[model samples]
Target: MSEVLEGVEKAEAEAVQIREKAQSQVEEIQRDAERKARGIEQIVRTQLTKEIEALQKSVESKAKNKSQRILLKADEEAVSLEEQGTKNIKKTVDIIIKGVYAFGGGGK
Candidate 1:
């Protein structure tokens, strides 16, 4: 009966040690998972920031290009109008000269 009691006590002590070790492992695993989750979140945030910046740059470049094209077209139209005005002025001068010389029966 004394031997039986010693065997039961030893088994209970071994069970207690096993339970403590398992608890420690569980805590370590939980801490590691939390750390990995934080690292992934940071990486995602950084990547998203870069992508957003790139998109903004792309949009700005397109807008600038469109503005330049509009300005160039306006300049071309101004030049065309100036050329037409110059031609009209020459025609008017010729008409005035003919009118001034009409008394002498001279015309161009």
Candidate 2:
């Protein structure tokens, strides 16, 4: 009977040790999972940042090109109007000269 009692105690002790070891393993696995999750989050954030920057650059380039085109068109229109004004001024001067000559009787 005493030998059976000792054996029971030994079995209980081994069971306690097994429980403690299993608890420790569970804690380690949780820590490893947390670390991996953090790493994955950081990788996703970096990728998003890079994509946003690239999109911003593309938008800026397109806007710049559009602005340049608008300015070139404005400049072309200004030149056309200036040429038309010059032609009108020459016609006005010729009309005035003819009227003056007729009124003055060709300077007598």
Candidate 3:
């Protein structure tokens, strides 16, 4: 009977050790999962930041190109108006000269 009691006590102690080991393994698994989740979150944030920057640059480039086109068109119209004004001035001067000559004011 004494030997049987010793064997029972030993079995109980072994069971307790097994339970503690299982708990420790569960805690380790939880820590590893949390670390992996944080890494994934960081990677996603970095990718989103890069994508947003690229989109902003594309928008800026398009706006710059459109503004340049508008400026070129404005310059062309200004040149056309200046040429028209010069031609009209020359015609007006010729008409005035002819009138003065007809009035016999050319000798003076």
Candidate 4:
């Protein structure tokens, strides 16, 4: 029965080799999947940072525009008030002059 023993030994050796090859393939696949996952994570983080920066810039621009408009409106109101005050002063001066002329007042 020497031939029977040799056949059994060869079959066991072939089985061991097949098992080792399958384990190696499984390890390689796991490593590749982990690498791809890390790459995706980095890309997402970069994109989010850019979007946040853009949003902040937009908010600042709008705020500055609103502040400028408010300042312009205040300036316009101040100018209008100054013009009215000058007109009132002129009217008062004219009235005083007319009263003095009506009376006989001559200062030399």
TM-score of each: 0.60, 0.61, 0.60, 0.56
lDDT of 1 by residue, 54-91 (tens): 99999999999999999999999999999988979988
Task: Compose the digit string of candidate 4's lDDT tens values, residues 1-108.
Answer: 999999999999999999999999999999999999989988998999899999999999999999999999999999998998787988878778878886877521
Each candidate: how many clashes? 0, 0, 0, 0
| Residue 34, model 3, lDDT | 96
lDDT for position 3 in model 4: 95
Q: Could you tell me the lDDT of residue 55 within candidate 3? A: 97
Candidate 3 lDDT over 1-108, as tens digits, reads 999999999999999999999999999999999999989988999999999999999999999999999999999999998998787997878888888887985622
Ranking by lDDT: 1, 2, 3, 4
Question: Which stretches in model 1 have alpha-carbon errors above 4 Å?
Answer: 81-108
lDDT of every model, 2 decimals: 0.95, 0.94, 0.91, 0.90
Those runs of model 3 whose alpha carbons end farther than 4 Å from true positions after fitting are 88-108
**What clash pairs does model 4 have?**
none
Best by TM-score: 2
TM-score of 3: 0.60
